[model samples]
Target: MLEQKGNLFILSGPSGVGKGTVLDALLKDYNDICYSISTTTREPRKGEVDGEDYFFASEDEFKSLVKKDEFLEWAKVHNNYYGTPKKYVDKTLEAGQDVILEIDIQGAKQVRDKFDGGIFIFLAPPSLKELESRINKRGTETKDAIATRLENANKELEEKKNYDYLVVNDQVEDAIKKIEAIIIAERCRL
Candidate 1:
């Protein structure tokens, strides 16, 4: 049997769609899949580690990377810069390990333009009302922030048709199962 080339899977969705929760569970069960850590200009939040959660970069450092074209995809989101570094992802995929990237819609679109072969999966909330509820439940955002997020969510939901798969996150377990199936099916393709 021939060794298969590793696949790049991009997971994106609205802010409150529980992408993080589903991904955490998925990673716990899957050993072959690798998570791609992104770089950001935002300050590390609460318990987020420097290299694990993200590569925390100063604005100047991030700009230097941009000039050097070190990112597969980068964008300014919510007033902070976020980008996927090209090195680790390229190295992982070349080594035949599947790499998964969780990014926003803007970065996903940028990836689409550059890497057409990657699998794009959109994690959608069960409903907009439910999405709003989830954001509220987080209790980390102000009313104005919540409103802004809802507006952005509305815009993102429209892009679902462009993605290869839509996994509605009504339940975390079910969503993970669906995404796992997607990975399996994609891997099976010749």
Candidate 2:
């Protein structure tokens, strides 16, 4: 018998919504799910490994892959190119391993348009004030950058209406449980 293909789950949220933390926890407990690594033209940060954190590429290489249609979705953000490659995702699913794509709103939209069956979950902060606090706590961005991110996050929050599920990340464990429930429910659907 042919192996059953696995499902695609796209998790999206604004910056500082703790999507990464929740995802990390989920993956730690679930060995069946595969996290899709994105390719980027931006330089790797300290301790970020190639092919694990991101597939770091040069401008020419990124452009070359774009032309060859190797990406499921690609976008230019903050003047850097980032994209999800199609091959590994396809192969993993073919081998019956579930795939989780942690991407931005633009890339999520692109995936939604191209792939009709995937689950799209939007992760929202408990409140804008909480979101602001979380972003500030990161201490990585300048004030101006933080303001820009907040503005963009407002726009992204609006897109939640288009998603299949809306998860509020008030507590990390609660959010992960909600997502786990969604996955179970989706899997049960005929």
Residue 47 Cα positional deviation in candidate 2, in Å, after optimal superposition: 7.0
- Residues 85-166 of candidate 2: C-alpha lDDT, one tens digit per residue: 9887888888888899988888899898877689999999998889999999999999999999999899889999989999
Best by TM-score: 1
List the candidates' TM-scores in order. 0.88, 0.87
lDDT of each: 0.91, 0.89
As a whole number from 0 to 100, the lDDT of residue 17 in candidate 2 is 90
lDDT of 1 by residue, 9-90 (tens): 9999998898888899999987779999999999999999998989999999999999998998999988999899988788
Give the number of the best model, judged by lDDT.
1
For model 2, how big is the CA root-mean-square deviation?
Answer: 2.3
Off by over 4 Å in 2: 42-53, 77-80
- RMSD score of candidate 1 (Å): 2.4
